[model samples]
Target: MDRMFRVLGFFTLAIGLMAFAGDLTEMALLFFLQTAFFVILGYMKFTERIYILLFWAYMFVTFTGFSYWTIFQMGLPL
Candidate 1:
């Protein structure tokens, strides 16, 4: 499970690097922060259920933020 977090961190780092190359600095920074977060979580000791819950909470927040940005900030057509 911890290994999974590290893997996710690396994947996020890769995405961040790609974003940076594409000139999406803000998105790259976001992914870089998330990569650091996942790496930190990977080193922490916690119950499996807690990790799962934390991940779900993370997903919810990320999705919600993305939705809010796309709808409100970006002003996409409905």
Candidate 2:
């Protein structure tokens, strides 16, 4: 499971880099946040601290949602 998260983290990092190269700042930021979450999950030494994952998930979702909302509000078609 740890290996899985590590792989996902690398994948997300690649995605973030691509987004950055494309100048898609919102997506790049979102993917970067996801990468951080996955990396943290991978390094966790105990399952008892699952709340950390929950916090990261909440952050990823909330931040991404708000990013989209702000973009929509600004009428940007990104």
Give the per-residue lDDT digits (tens) of candidate 1, residues 1-78: 887889999999999999999999999999999999999999998889988998999999999999998889999785
The candidate scoring highest on TM-score is 1
| Tens digits of lDDT, candidate 2, 13-67 | 9999999999999999989998998899788854645645755776798899889
TM-scores across all candidates? 0.93, 0.60
Candidate 2 achieves a global lDDT of 0.83
Name the TM-score of candidate 1: 0.93
Root-mean-square deviation of candidate 1: 1.1
lDDT of 2 at 64: 95
Off by over 4 Å in 2: 47-78
C-alpha lDDT values of all predictions: 0.94, 0.83
